[model samples]
Target chain A: MKKYIAKRVLNALFVVWLVATVVFFGLRAIPGGPVRTMLGAEATEEAVNRMRAELGLDQPLYVQYAEWMLDLITLDLGQSLTSGEQISVMMASAVPRTLSIALIGVVVGLGIALPTGIISATRKGQRSDYVATVAAFLGLSMPAFFIGILLALVFGVWWGVLPIVGYAPLQEDGIVEWFRRILLPGISVGVPYAAVVMRMTRSSLLEVLDAEYMKTAKAKGVGRTTRLYKHAMQNALIPVVTVAGIQIALVLVGSVTVELVFGIQGIGRLLVDAILDRNYPVTQSVILLVAAIMVFMNLTVDIIYTFLDPRIRYGDEAS
Target chain B: MTMLEIRNLRTEFETQRGTVTAVNGVDLHIDNGEIVGLVGESGSGKSVLAQSVMRLVEDPGEVTADELLFKGEPLLEKSEAEMTAIRGNEISMVFQDPMNSLNPTITVGEQIAETVRLHQDVGESVSLSAEMKRKIIGASKASESWRRAIEMLESVQIPHPESRATDYPHEFSGGMRQRAMIAIALSCEPDLLIADEPTTALDVTIQAQILEELHDILEVFDTSILLITHDLAVVAETCDRVNVMYAGEMVERATARDLFENPQHPYTQALLASTPQVETAVDELKPIPGTVPEPIDIPYACHFAPRCPEAKEECFEVDPAFRRVGSEGHEAACIRREPVDGEVIENE
Candidate 1:
């Protein structure tokens, strides 16, 4: 267990290094100077150069990269280029909104998907299964942004039932009101995620049902429900875990679109604004945050494998 | 009175390919305390026949039996609820692969005790009052039943019945897993214990030890066994009466001694001839020529005709009925059993 954890930590550090380096260089290569974009055409070339020096962008690429890495190692993400505030503090403000939206979305997605998936797989070739498959297909095809707008048009504009656009921090008010405000946008973002998870769960479960061990369980004369939940579902969860991990990354991507549609002040929206304004620090920090989460999510899935399957371990150690 | 009697049992499956007859008109009987070995090759439907008796065969697969009774109770007509009650209570089954048979997540002892508690009804007051009831009781079973479960494990010669029983299925070796399966099967002490190739997945030495342990258990218990296997040596060692199956039908049924000493059916003869002798490096071991017919689009008459070396024109035209061959209760479903010319090769 110690060795497994050690290996995972080292692997996570390697991933963070790769992600940070790629983001730094890729943003640098984009077809505009950061200082000129931030200052605009009104500023003189000398003033732009002066601004670039002040921002430390005038340094050689390798030196800038080394400084950034050093800052990152010391947990000093530096101040936002435009805001003149710590990037970490900016993240602290935006991350909760993004996470809340994603969390509610995930819960709703699983709530809709798990039972539906299991039932669809169990009933298999039945009317309900066919209906679920069709719904999943529709959900998969429909874009979250389009879905959000459509929902906002119907419910927010027409019925006036929900706050269609914008976000409220949960700290100012209670969780319930915050949840009520976020529901429509969260659901819109979650629909595709839920559909993907549902399809994966159903397919994986169907395969597990046909496995030899399931037959053995049934032959034991155990109740159908017990056999399904305990025997079949447990085995089926490996792929479900995988699909969920992938969905986390997809959800982060979807958040950008969701933030734009709903007018939510989230990290995804901030990242987009930072890119548009050439705010290097904010954009780099956001990218690093996302990369960190993705790395963490992947690590979580890997760690879960040992628990899910007895045969799996970090370094093929005798457990 | 017979503990279990299955007459003209047939299990047909409807697949996308076509409707297939898996267990075609097979008859089997096991009287009280008799271990009946149902031996055949893989596709011969030995497992299917055993499953059919339990009504474990699911939908799109129909199990039809002219008469199937357990202790004079009609099995075929029983409701799903009724069948559920019968299964794991009056009749318990141990499967071929122990790895697949036991639930992976559940502990070995809990698996056995669950079966015990499912069938029996023991009051909480009665259970609690008993001094021996230190451990948990799944559902409701008498305190004695828990001890009996431990005893069952011990009887199966499982090392460290207490500690080992707590371990899950994946923790066990092949032999130990088979032992745990036997423990679970025998936990309820059902009247009929169906061991469906129980030793097939075990090593040869383990298989022999398991068979020996099974025989010892049978000596003590009043239970009848339906031992299903493709291994002829297993039958010769453990079984009292042997039924030879070919392509879902029973080709021969007789005492183990009678069947082996004086084989009747051509398929049975071929099967015996094919049995590998360890002593001799026989250059050409006789193997049955053709494979068993496909379950779908099966032959109209005798299913084994294509594979039978001595198959005549009549074999293809008519389904040969089981005719009494020699001595009492000995039967075979072959055309050329009578008026044989050659001396039978006896295994010395």
Candidate 2:
């Protein structure tokens, strides 16, 4: 088991390196350099060339890559080509906002989906099931940005209950203030994600409720709640967890749009602004961070499976 | 004494096509420590009858009986909470598919332990202390249930049972998995065990071994068994009394000896003839001619009339009621079968 985990960690590291390398070179291949974007189109050729030399754009691609790789190894992400602010400093602020949004996306999505799935599946064909089914359709049909705008209008503009724009960093403003601001955008990003997971959970749980094991459990005199929660859920959750992990990665990407709607400066907005300004270090860092998160979540999902089912933990044995 | 009694029990399902009767007015009983066999091909409603006794049929399926008793207690009158207490404590079941019958995520031991803990009193439980190698089970119920799980595994003749108890269901072979299920069902030591084709998925050798072990295991618990199977050979060896089901109805009921020696109903006779006998030539082993009639909106007729060689014109018009055959306590449903003195005949 330890050997398998070791192999997985190494594999994860290799994937991150591959993604970082691809994203780094791909950003550099764009039509114009960060120096040109920084200086303006009407600037003299001498001014543009000098700015390009200062930013190491005059060097060969491999040389620039080698230099960036060294800085990466030493935890130096270099300054933004346009703003000249340290890319690492920017991440200190933006990464937390994105991380909080993603965290709440998971919390709210799973929180709503798990109970809704269980209730609807157990009470199938009832009014409550119909309500949940209709709500899931609405969540799926409306995009996250639209949900964000609607949420902003109700909670922030009309109701005047919460802030509509901007993020409060946890360390700077404390948790209550941070949560109060992140909630609107967080739920907007989460609603669509919850719908996908709820559908997966409902269908998967229904399938599990019909499984032979559940009948066995029932025949053994397990109570209705015990049969649904204990016997049916563990098996049902395997598929839900896998789907949730994938949806969460998509939520991270979807949060970019929500961030724009809410004016929260998360990595989604950071990546967008950096891309338009042609800031290579900031863009590359944002992409690498997102890649790392996806890789980590995948690893986490697989590890959770091993705990849920010993068969995966003892995978080396003959069946 | 009767362990379970079902009188005129009928199970119906409301589907898109209309009401489909699965078990139609079936009458049966299991006496103390008796092993009864219910023999039928697929779609005969033998399984539905078993589920009806336990009230396991859920939405869209309905089980109604004039009299349903377990240990002389009115089963139909019991509330669901009371039924839950009876299930696994008074009546237990082993399903057909061993591979799918168990939860794959849990260890075989935990599955067994859960039932042990759910039904067994902690004060009565004795754990590893019986082995004299490890410390006895703790005061906690969990340790005691775990001990019973290993003991149950060992009783089923699983090798390395101490270790095998910790193994998941997939780790066990088909035969071993069935044995594990048997262990689970027997762990609670209920008064009755409903084993539905428990050994059908196993090889013949493993099948025999499992049935033999089940016989011995249930003997230890003094548990009655309703062995539901399509295998005549298995019924011939293991069951004391036999019930033959044909298309949702009990077509024949007799002692195993009487049923096999002087088979009466045409369906029963046909079933006996279809089974390959060692004394008979290979070509003589004839398959029963027709499939079981589709159960939807079945007409008021002997369900086996279409398949029976001796079915008369009247057989298609009236359903046959149980009538005495050659022996006492032996009954067969057929239009031509002799009615016992004072036994009510359905038509004239």
Candidate 3:
């Protein structure tokens, strides 16, 4: 077990290293230089040279990547070109806001989808199953942005029950107010994820139910509900977990649209702004952060398989 | 009194192409301590009949029986919960493919204990108490459960029950897995055990061992068995009473000795003759010519007439009723058993 855990940890670090290297070099290849974008067209050569040197952009690409990697060990993320502030501080503030929306959305999405999926699979060929399947397909086909706008128009603009667009930090307000501010965007962003999870759960459960063991369980006189939760759902969760892991990256991407639609000033919106202004360091850092998050999420998914299926472990004789 | 009596039981499945009748009007009876073998070819609906006893068929599948009684109680009238009480407690089932019959996630001992806890009235303290719990921990209950499992493992004569008990289904040999499944089914000491092709998935040698184990277990427990199989050799060896099903109908029913020695129905005689015997090196075994009819579009008359060499014009025109042929309880569903011109020829 210790060896298995060690191997997984090593693999995770290797993946993170590969991602960092790609991000460092990949951003440099983008059309314009950060030095030119940072300074306006009328800026002097002296000022531009000073700014580039100060930001370490004048250094060789390999040197910059090595220094950045070393700095990561000391918990330093360098400075943002646009804000002239520490990237860590900007991320510190923005991470919570982005996380708050994504976390709640993921929780709600899973909570709604799990029961819906199980019910649909159990009621296979019934009207309820048909309706759920059709609804999930529709949810998948429809864009989150369109859903977000439709919701905003109806709930925000017309009813005036929710704020049309903007984020209210929990530090500045009560829990209810905090929820009120982020809830709409969170749910709107989660709708698509929930639909995907629901469909996955339904299909997985349906397949598991058809397995021979399930028939054995039924023959043992186990109740339908008990059989579903005890024997079926746990086995079905492997696929759902895989989908959820991939969806985390998709959620991070979708949050950009959600932040723009809801007028929330989050990392996604900040990242978009930095890209538009050609703020190289901030854009590079943000892309690296997203890549890093995805790597970590995939690692988490791999780790979770050991717990979900005893048949699999980190270094069990390769299946 | 009869433990289970099923009469005119029919099961049909609604497939994408059309509705197909799997078990059509199968009548069966099992008295206490009686072992009845249901012998037939594949698609004879042996498993379907077993499943219908528990109402295990799901949506797109339907079962209808004119009379299905369990211990004098009307089984069709019972609620779901009541049926559940009867299942594990009274009539448990052991399936053919042992590797897939058990829950993959759970431990073998726990799976056995779970059935015990579900069916029996053991208090929580008594069931889960330190004394009972310690056995699992000390490897004592593990060994005992292991020993018993292995004994059952040995009952089926599977090698090394001690080591085999700790292993998962994938770890065991096919015959060993079947033995483990038998152990699971017999754990609760159920009144009736429905074994659906218990040896079909096993090799010939292992099949004999499993049959021996089943026979020994039944002898000790006084438990009745409803054995479903396609192999006539197995039935001839293990069964006391036999029912021959053809196209979902019980075409012949008699004592195993009577059925084998003085076969009544033409289908039964044809089936017996078709099997390759140990003594015979017949150049070629006569294969039954026509296929079993498509159940959904089954002819209104005799289902086996199209396959029977002795079939008459009237056989294709009218559905035959089950008729008792002579003094014995040997019953056959054919119209040619009556005396005519000093020979049993046609309808009365």
Candidate 4:
């Protein structure tokens, strides 16, 4: 197990390195440099040259890449080209802000998906299942932004129950207000994700529920609840967990639009601004971080598989 | 004593087009510690009859019986909850398709132990719902059932019971998995065990081992089994009495030996001839003429009339009811066995 995980970690690092190399070269390959964006075309050639030289943009691509790689190895993200603010600090704040809402989205997604999926699977073809199916389609088809606006209108404007526009940092605002501030935005991103998770759960569970083993369990005198939850649910959860891991990336991508919708400052918005402003350091760092997360999530899913199924782990190991 | 009895039992599926009767009016019983085989080809409703007895038939399928009694108790009148207690504890089942019947993710021992805990170690008050969280019970009790689980594994002749107890079902071979299932069904030493084609998916050698295990279980646990299968050889090896069904109804029934020796019903005769014997060459194998008709297509006349070689005009018009045949307790649903006014289709 340790060896397997070690191998996975090495594979993950190689992927991150590959992504880092792509973004470093790819960002530079774009038509213009950050110096010009910072100085504007109005600036004289000499002024532009001076700015480029200062920013290390005037150097050969290999030289700049080497230096950037060195800096990255030393855990130094450098400063934003435009702001001269520490890139790491910017990320530290932005990542959490983004991850917090995404976490809430996951929580809400699972909260809605688990019960509804189980109910839909067990009472399949019944009224509740049909209702859930219809609701799931609506959730899937509707865009996050539209859902965000709908929520904002209902909870923020119509009933005036929850805040829609404000950003609440948990450390400052305490748990209740933090949740209150984030809930609407969280639901906006979550509803669509919930639909996906719910569908996966329902279909996966429906298949397992009908499995011959489930009948075996029933004949063994297992109750209806036990058959569905204990006998069936664990097997069904394997696919749901896999989909959920992949969906985490979706949540990251989702938080970008949702952050804008609710006016929260997160990594996604920071990445967008960095790209628009041609801030090389910030853009490169954000892109690498996202890639690293992707690699990490994939590894986590594989590791989870070992625990969920003995076949994956012991099947090879024992042999 | 009678272990299981089903009289006038009918199982039907209410399909969109119409109601498809799967198990037509069927009367059968199993005696204590005996393996009573329900034999038929695929789609003959033998498996459906097993599911009906367990009340595990999925919907649009419905089961009704004049008397669905188990161990002298009327199972039809019992609530689902009451039935749940009786299942696995009083009457468990071993299904076909051993490869898929055991949960792939669960440890074989844990699966067996769960049944033992749910119905054996835990008191009656531990409602069926409590099965979801057996760990919440006292740790000592939990470990106690775990011990029983390992014992069950050992009893099934699985090697390294202590270690294999932790291994999942997929780790066990097909034959071993079937044995594990037998171990589970007999865990509570239930009065009746419904083994539906338990050895169907196994090879000949493995099939023999499984039958050996079933016989061992009968001696050790004294558990009566409703062994449903398509193999005449398996019934000859394991069953005491045999009930032959054809397209949802009991066509013939008798002692396993007598049924094979003198099959009164033409369908039974056809089935016996269809069996590939080592005594004959390959081409001598007599395949049944037509497939078992789908439930909806089954005629009001004798289910086998369309396929029976001796089928007469009246055989296609009127259903033949079960009538006495060669020996005491032997019955066959064939008009020839009936003492009608006219000697239609003279005795051969």
Candidate 5:
């Protein structure tokens, strides 16, 4: 098990490195350079050269990449070319905001999906199942930003029950207010994700519930509750967990639009701003960080599979 | 004394095609300490009949009977809750496929103990003896149940029951898993044990071992068994009474010896001829011609008339009810009274 985890960690590091390299080269390949964006249309050639040299943009791509990689190795994110602010500081705040929204959105998604999926599977062809199915379809079809706007209109503008825009750090605003601020955006990102999760859970559980073992459980005179939850659900959860792992990326991507709609200054919004102003350091770091997080989540999901099924041991079968 | 009796029991399933009757009006009974074999072809509703006895058929499958009695009490009148209490407590079932019959995630011991815990009200005490009271109290605990689980496993001849109890279903071999399943079914000391093709999935060697284990179970448990199988040899070896089913109805009912020696029904005769005996050096096997009719298209008169070579004109006009043949107890569903000679009558 230790060796398996060690191999996974090594693979994860390689993936993060690949993402960082790709983002670094890809950002530089765009038509407009950071120097042009920083100086604007009025700047002269000499001023452009001076600014380019100062930002190490005049250096060869490999040298610049190597230096940047060295800085990243020591946790130094350098300064943003457009804002002249520490990129590390900007990311420290932005990452937490984005992480909070994604975490809450995933939790909300699972909270809605798990019970409703179980209910729909068990009570198939019933009224409750039909209702949940229709609702899930609606959730799946609508875009995250559209859901955010609708929520803001009903709960913010019309009802005055919640703050419509902006974000608050938990450390500064306390837990209750922090949740209050993040709730709308979280639900907006969560609904579509919940739809995906609900569909997967329902289909996966439906199959497991029909398995021969389930028939054995029923014939054993196991109570309906124990049969469904203990015998069926555990087997069903394996596929659901796989879908949930894939949804971590979806939630992260959805948060980009969700952050813009809710006016939250999260990493997603920072990435958007950095791209608009051509801020190389901030854009590359944010993309790399998101890739790292996705890799880590996948690793966690793989570990969870061993816990759910003892037969699924990594690297043991081949040896 | 009769342990279970079924009168005119019918099981039907509503599929996209139509309501197909799997088990037609069939009457059967099992006496205490008797091993009865329900013998039939693959689609002849033997499993459905066994499941009906336990009321295990789910929705879309309807089970109806004029009288479904257990211990002389009408079971059809019992509520679902009442039936649940009776199931696994008074009666239990072993399914066909041992490979998938157990929950994969659970330890074999836990699965067996669950049946014991569900049926046996472990915490309730009506006795005054200190040891009895202690047992009653300990019954609710996991340790006590697990200990009983090991004992049940040991009863089924599973080697290393103590350590094997902690292992999951996949850890056990095919025959061992079947034994473990039998262990679970017999844990509550049910009065009637339903074995549904219990040895069909096993190899010939493993099948013999399992049959031996079953004999041991009969000796120790003192339970009536309704063994469902298509293998004539299995029935001939194990059963005391045999009910030969054709198209969801009992074609012949007799003692094992009588059924084998003086087979009366034309369908029963064909079944016996087709069976390859060790002593007979037959050049080729005689398989029964034509397949069993689809449930939706079963003949209204005699279901076997299309397949039976000796079927007369009247057999096509009217269904034959089970009537006494030569013996006092032996009965067969055929118009012919005298024993037909072993003639290879070609299919019309």
Candidate 6:
């Protein structure tokens, strides 16, 4: 198991390196340089050259790439060219807000999905199944930003239950206030994700419930609760876990739109602003961070699979 | 001394196609300490009948019986909660496909111990010997259930029960997993154990070993067994009484010895002839001529008439009731009650 985890960690490092390299090169490929965006279109060639030289853009791509790679190794993400602020410092503030929204969105998604899926599957043709199915379809059809707007209109503007815009830092405002602020955006992002998970869960559980082992469990006189939760659900979770892992990345990406609608300054919003202003380091770092998160989540899911199924031992005799 | 009794039991399923009667009107009984075999082809409703006894058949499948009794108490009248108390505690089941029968995620031992824990009660009063009472008390404790689980595993002939108990089903060989299933089924010392094709997924050698272990365990545990199988030889070797089922109905029933010696029903005779005997050499193997009738479109008169060699004109027009034949405790469903000669009797 140690060997397996070591190999996975190495693989994750390689993936993060690959993403960093791609983002570094890809950002430079764009027509407008960060110098042009910072200095404005009317800037003279000498001023552009001086600004470029100061930012070390005059150096060869290889030297710049090597220096950036070295800085990355030492956890030194350089300052933003546009704002002259530390990219790391900007990320420090934005990362937590984005992470909270994604995490809470996922928790909310699973919370709604698992039970609804199980109920829809077990009571297949019943009214509850139909209701869940219709609700899932509606959730899937609506976009995350649209849901956020709708929620803001109802809960924020009309009902006056929640603040319509802006984010609160948990450490500054306490957890309760932070949670109240995060809840709307989280649900908006979560609804679509919950629909995906719910559908996956229903289908996966239906297949598992039809398996011969499930019948064996039923024959053993296991109670309905034990049979569904203990026997059927555990087996059903393999596919659901895979889908949920992938959905985490989706939620992170979708949080960008949700963050815009809710006016939360998170990593997603920072990436958007960085792209517009052509802040190369911030854009590349934020994109690389999101990619890293996706890779890590997938790796975690694979590790969880080993724990869920004994038959799936990794780095054993067989590959 | 009867452990279970079923009278005119029928199991029907409502499907998109139509209402399919899986198990037609049937009467079956198992006595205390008896090994009864229910033999049938696939889709003959043997498994459905077993599920009906435990009320394990799911929605859209309806089970109705004139009387479904366990220990002379009507099971049909019992609520699901009452049935849950009886299940695994008073009556347990071992299923086919050892590879899948046991839950793959859990250790084999915990699966066995769970059955014990689910039904364990400390204050429930029952007449028991002092040793049995002490064992029951020990089993009621959470930690002691694991110990009892390992003991049950050992009783089923699993080697190194302590370590093996912690291993998942995939870690065990097919035979060992089947043994583990038997161990779980018998952990609570149920009065009846329903083993549905317990050896079907095993190798021939492993099949014999599992049957031997099951026989020995049954003797020691003093539990009645309802062994469901399609193998005639398995029934002959392991069962005292045998019921031959055809198309959701019992066509013949007798002591294993009598059924083997004087098989009366044409379907039973064909089944014996089709089975390859170890000592008998024949020019060509005789296969049963036709498949079982579809459940929804089962023949009104006789289900086996299409395949029976001795089927007469009446066999296609009338359904024969089960009748006592030459020997006591021997019964068969055939218009001709007498035993047939080697020559076939032409239909007129």
Q: Tell me the tens digit of each residue's lDDT in model 6 across B24-133.
A: 88889999999999999998999999999988888889999988999999998999988888888888898888887888877787778777666775333322332233
lDDT of each: 0.81, 0.86, 0.78, 0.85, 0.86, 0.86
Question: How does residue A264 of candidate 1 score in lDDT?
Answer: 89
* TM-score per candidate for chain A alone: 0.95, 0.95, 0.92, 0.95, 0.97, 0.97
Question: Where is model 6 more than 4 Å wrong at Cα?
Answer: A38-47, A315-319, B120-142, B336-348
DockQ of 6: 0.42
lDDT of 4 at A227: 74
Q: Clashes in each model (backbone N, CA, C under 3 Å)?
A: 0, 0, 1, 0, 0, 0
Candidate 5 residues A1-319, lDDT tens each? 8889999999999999999999999998888988788788899999999999998889999999999999999989889988789998998888888888898899999999999999999998899999999999999999888999999999999999999788888999999899999999999889999999999999999999888888777777776777777678778999999999989888888899999999999999999999988899989988989899989999999999987775677985552
TM-scores for every predicted model: 0.92, 0.94, 0.89, 0.93, 0.93, 0.91
User: What is the C-alpha lDDT profile of model 3 across A52-105, one tens digit per residue?
Assistant: 898777988789888888887797888887678998888888877788778877
Off by over 4 Å in 3: A40-54, A172-174, A316-319, B14-18, B125-168, B324-327, B336-348
- Retained true contacts (fraction), each candidate: 0.24, 0.66, 0.49, 0.80, 0.46, 0.50
Model 2 chain B weakest lDDT span, ten residues long: B130-139
Candidate 3 Cα lDDT to native: 0.78
| Candidate 3 local Cα displacement, residue A152, angstroms | 2.9
Q: Model 2: per-residue lDDT, tens digit, B104-165?
A: 97779878887776788954332223321111121232487889999999999999988898
lDDT of 6 at A39: 85
Pick by DockQ: which candidate is best?
Answer: 4
What is the per-residue lDDT of model 3 for residues B105-189, given as tens digits with 9 covering 90 to 100?
5555445545555665544221234323433343344333434445555555656655655555666677877776777677668
Candidate 1 per-residue C-alpha lDDT over B151-238 given as tens digits, one digit per residue, 9 for 90 to 100: 7788888888877766678889989888988887777678999999999999999999999978877887778999999998899888
Candidate 2 vs candidate 4, lDDT winner: 2
